[model samples]
Target chain A: MNRIAAFSIGAASGVVGTYLTLKEREDLKVEPKVFKYGRPDSPVSFHSYSAHSLAYDRARKIPLWVIERLSPHDIKKEITADRHRSNFQPDPFVSPHYSSANTDYFNSGWSRGHMAAAGNYKHDQKCMDDTFYLTNILPQDLDNNIDYWYRLENYCRQLVKKGYSLTVISGPLFLPEERDGKKIISHQVIGDNNVSVPTHLFKILLAEREDEEPPLLGSFIIPNKPVSDCPLRTFQVPLETIEKHSGSHFLQNLQRNKALDLCDKDGCKTISLNELTLYRYAQKLEQATSKEALEKLWAEMESKAIKLDKHITAIYKKKMNEF
Target chain B: MNRIAAFSIGAASGVVGTYLTLKEREDLKVEPKVFKYGRPDSPVSFHSYSAHSLAYDRARKIPLWVIERLSPHDIKKEITADRHRSNFQPDPFVSPHYSSANTDYFNSGWSRGHMAAAGNYKHDQKCMDDTFYLTNILPQDLDNNIDYWYRLENYCRQLVKKGYSLTVISGPLFLPEERDGKKIISHQVIGDNNVSVPTHLFKILLAEREDEEPPLLGSFIIPNKPVSDCPLRTFQVPLETIEKHSGSHFLQNLQRNKALDLCDKDGCKTISLNELTLYRYAQKLEQATSKEALEKLWAEMESKAIKLDKHITAIYKKKMNEF
Candidate 1:
């Protein structure tokens, strides 16, 4: 019985090896060019392909088990890390660690700039926060990260209109350090509490349109200063707070109504001063500085008349024209 | 007349502006993911396809001009620099320039290695040599290049049975600095004194066989030690002497036979014996005392009327048995 069992094991091993060899041979036969380096009987085969092709193929071939395990956070992390590995530096504004004193450029007075605006993401914090990975960080002048940055953000928003989802990662390759020292990392102070330094940042927008081929990647480097504008920005609010406050429900509503297109649907126009007062009271509750202040603000707003439909229309129209 | 010329120029400018705007819009339509980081507007696009797809799509989208503009030597340089960049921290066998000279082990020891080994590719020198660049350099041990590095010098006689034109490049990645305390670019020594170091090597085989790919790349990594009873006297000789003594006709014949699989067929096959000879003679010459000793060694084999054909047959049989 033992002898028979040994024989069976040997036979199974032989069959497995033979099957693997045959499969490899078939693959080589189908595309001889793939084995241009010559088959070495190694487990891993090396072949050269373009970055875009690799990404698409990988996305398709990812095992179901792997996909099942991935969350929105996981997907965001993987995309963020991959972008960083490919040389995307992080934006400092959204990164809490940058403001930490332990970093190389603590309090260096440089702002972390995001090529993708936080608001355009409907203020999703995880998406915004992913831009804080070091690989996504790059140095930018303060003015450039603030002023022209908004323009570029608007440009990306415009791209969404044309059925293209923009995935932008941009930053300076090098930065001047302390006037004369070898250029080191830089940092930004956030809300008078935390300091941050970002090395690289990226924003990836998955396509919304059905007919268009989704953009699988994108990157850019901010040119050296002396030019008028680099056009990048740093977010004022923490991405987490923004994401929680904005909520997925609000985003869904915006998309459904084509709020991005700045249009309103179902004109059931009505106004109630009491409703307006209630909305202001809720807003005050969300933004109150202290418990006492919050109570006072809410009481003041609640006392006033509230209007709903008229206010919504006015705000919606104003946002539509702004875009 | 001046006013009419000014008007015509203004009309042309307007047309140009219209064209530029249209181009910008087309660019904006591109997904942001496709853009490379440093070069936002670069025209070059990269894509990877499966070997099968690549085979089917071949109208040779890679332009002839582009291929022509890039020399194998230039590519080698780029590849070498990239290897260094990727492997900034050198490993056990591969030492950095700063670390190589500091080691005492390499001085008294000889490694039993393949002059044209596949593993040497990570170092870049093996692939750059002209002789080892040939396809025929096969599974050689350390003794072959160090002590018997000469016995295998005329192994080309064994190649005829394989029914392929073998191209080989063999040379060293480093030439010891002549003066103490002087720095040397260990990877740049392609040839020296009309000859080149032959420690590093590569091989390519061009044969029309059912299983053989038209172009193939392989290499070997010779050990840093000497051995006794060097089974084969595969020695190195001075490349210049190999060409001058072998005669130009012999060299020309080899080139013509191997020219069928040029990297860029349309480009000129400008053979340089300088690079080829260095690679060919590296192992043999390293072991030989002088050019006379090398020639006398070959003459001895000729006088013996060596059964080169029989030896080649035996080698092939041996290789087949391994498989």
Candidate 2:
């Protein structure tokens, strides 16, 4: 692989591009178009494209994990409208892999869910279209897809708005269940080719900075079913658990000790919905367009943020002590 | 949750039964009938009964994992013959869990294969019958069920015959597949309720001895597809991989380190069928009953065992050195 010379476009500090490192290329079974920040020779930092950063399982025709990096520029990208419904198609790049066809989802109760969410790539039409590749989607429960999982996706983007460069890996899992006395794969399947419904969906978030400190990791494993608007922390698990389930390790190329070990044990949080009232408020703040509306949203946001911050701080403190 | 008194029957040294420990009882979302060996107050060891040792997922009426232990005496019991084919029924215990019915497999083109092998418990009618529960079954590839997976099950029992007490945990996994460039659950479903077919099945074995050394762990994650009669080591994966995919931890209750870390890296075994020819010989010897037949089987077994012994010893020695 040749190293392409660094080029800047539009802004002085632009979205940099990098391909998979030699080590990652050797480790991955399928080739992916991985785009990262800085020059081809620079130390690996945050990534922007997830078209090929996935670990593909050829027998199953699904990725074990999909990774994407987001920054403030990504969250503010507004050049394109959401045309995911119209533009959904098979990815032209991954041939012979035999990804699921669009017709396979017809009449199936599950909604076509995104793994590398489209909203995170709305800045470039090409990037947004890339997210529509069938390789980036999983069969998700309708209620969980639109209401809960989507909210979690937005929250990840919000963190980017708060200036944190993050690397996110999201995927599906088929956990075992006991029937008579033995554990077996027991879940619903849709269509003739057998599009399996995921028992659970997991997302792992890592905060990376230029500093020497270890990255702070937050991992979650949520059931792919209707769930209440409880605090997101309810589903947090350890990075080790997510790594084990996906059969691929994350941030392995960046060797550093874990700064915190979260949800390594039982008794994860399950707080009341009242604690997440600010989350609902944040949704409304996003829609405020006029000057009057902006002023009113800011007033409401300030009041709710104070209350929610204290509540969330207490919850995080207790979880920290538990860890 | 009450502690029932231990009971013994038939032999002077009885098969001791212990239910799910209080710790497992608390961690499990649904109750299972777990039976452990040794005194009620002692730490959990090799489990004999899996009725409650299962980790059940209510969304999908299936267990995450099942554990069982066997002895030579336990294997020799011939009180009952295999009645699994005719005695299948829905588990009455996992109500609201809504396990699949027999009709689901009627025309699905897949076999209702048991996660827990019935032959292992054939000596006792109740135990053998328990293996027929629909919860203990999964939709498996017909050829794989009858040939590949079944052979692996017998091999575990063969290990028991060699005087090694083992804690065996077997479960199913739903791996992700990409369709149209999107990672989705891709597998076949059967019947009206869409009982899903698993992409793979995993079995983890921990050989425990009454010695100071750590237990030997053997893990296999086999695809739910047609397989050849090759060395079983071809499918070996790290125990950590199984735990991650199943979302449940084994041997967590038992505080000990692994005797050997197997398959944690690349270069896992993919030996030829010639090395495993003794396995076929053993299967033939199992069918021998008459004096002439036993003599003929013994003669053939001696020849094959000698060759297999050298081949296996060399493979094991290489593996041990690498570990």
Candidate 3:
């Protein structure tokens, strides 16, 4: 509280901040010059899969972020990998003490939503299957998981379909909002392990256009809850905001000023999901645990007000039962 | 909520847990045995100082932990360095985006408290000053900073005086407690940069006694707020608990059964602060900002009872003014 204030801090810091200027290894040497005491250990760890790489948060038992690159060739026409053949599983590489488990999401009134969407990795069966690992999932809201968020992922692929390849980064965010005059970041955690439920989710993309034009960089910070009313462009934010919130720098290889705004270049809009897709979504929603949530899901279903023919309902019911 | 329950999580996890069985760099290669994608980037960074090394959380702009090995020789007689001459400064190596500044704590109604204390590094002025880097600091409460927590640090040095060399790990914790039937971790952030103010602070100590016997490991997690009534031993919890909360492993090379309890070996008690010591603390208190806080601090002073008379008060006032 002894108010040292800003000017003093800025002045004092400019002198000592140079300690790390020598290298990215950032060895800091001060006067009287002494060697480092010991090696530093990473509080978080990174893992790789066929289509993606992710940094896991050891403390939260969740992935901090997932990075994936999608090329036109990687986005093939038919499903080369059937997601149905792949069941969700825990990652083998992470220690049990730190890794998230499939059960963390099972009946916790939340769905294990993929950060790197399984459908995006369909070029190879293994690529799609690996996306089911717990490290790539989060305790996501059912509505957000299978509906709007699903559409966003589709939107990413739509761009790929439009002849642009993309490097996508997705992650959870425990964002602070003004609550009762204080900026508070609060979220529920699931399972005995207390795996966190993020309040928001982010997707940052670098889409490389054909020809000599610079690639476009765009970012979205969407609420974890469903948002069906607004356009996808409403969620778009500056890249610096994402770095400030996620603590991870993205597109380090690209100069941001030279890059174009993704949403500006290619409009951010999601097509309405077909009826069969919504029925399939209802199947995933069946796994949600909370009694109130089940009731709420039914309420939402009733509000949809679109009923398919009896034959389709019968077929959907059979498919749902099989699932 | 689909309450999948604890049993389901435990059951599902045991089957797929072996992916990391091969190595610590747990490369989880699933069916199809495909090579990994690009390398995952670390969300956090690490840096080293002469007396300590720390893992810095890039997003939070704070050190996750600071570790120091304090031997008998390291605890020099009298003071080889005066802390009065060493002003707090920022570590140059940390990028401005991810590093905490002296400004973050300035006039933020919190103190810049050192994890590896300056007093503990009196072996040399450089070592002592290196500990002042903002990377090794937290936004600490004023009352706890100079009083109870100070005594606990003194206790660590006191153990070193007893022919024991100590390896100490210190950091801040954002612990959650049951609020309205839900576990919520909530803390106020300080400065325009929103530097996090931890709700609790921890000190994990591994003290090796002067013998062939194995070392003792003990940990304490104390509330960031002032606590004048309870004994320090009340804060002593099992090592496993600290691991769960902090997500950092300690005594990795030593088996638990061989190690003894640190608090049991040396009684967990703090020596009373003498009259002069209390007077100096009062001077430090003057920097505190809140009117209500100032009132409460004076109230705490009056409750201490015994007075130090006029000449001492005059000298203390002069010192306070100078500070």
In terms of TM-score, which candidate is strongest?
Answer: 3
By TM-score, highest first, what's the ranking?
A: 3, 2, 1
Candidate 1 chain A TM is 0.30
User: What tens-digit string does per-residue lDDT give for candidate 1 at B86-189?
Assistant: 22111111111111111221222223233333222332442323112111122223444534343232332233223433444332221122234322212111
- Rank by lDDT, highest first: 3, 2, 1
lDDT of 2 at A68: 70
Candidate No. with top lDDT = 3
lDDT of candidate model 2 versus the reference = 0.54
The residue-by-residue lDDT of candidate 2 on B45-78, one tens digit each, is: 1111232133333223344455556656677766
For residues B192-298, could you state the per-residue lDDT of candidate 3 as single tens digits?
A: 55677888998888888667387877889989998675677899887666655655555455567778888787776676655436656466565655555555655
Q: Per-residue error at A311 for model 2, in Å?
A: 21
True contacts kept of 3: 0.21
Model 2 chain B poorest ten-residue lDDT run: B36-45
Estimate, for each residue in A158-244, the C-alpha lDDT of model 2 and write its tens digit.
667756677777888766555554445445655544555678888877654554356556789989999887777888877655543
CAPRI-style quality class for the chain A–B interface of candidate 1: incorrect
In candidate 3, which residue ranges exceed 4 Å CA deviation? A1-19, A22-40, A273-323, B1-40, B272-303, B307-323
lDDT of 1: 0.26
Query: Against the hidden reference, what TM-scores do the models get?
Result: 0.24, 0.41, 0.79
Best by DockQ: 3
Error of 3 at B267 (Å): 1.4
Alpha carbon deviation, residue A270, candidate 1 (Å): 37
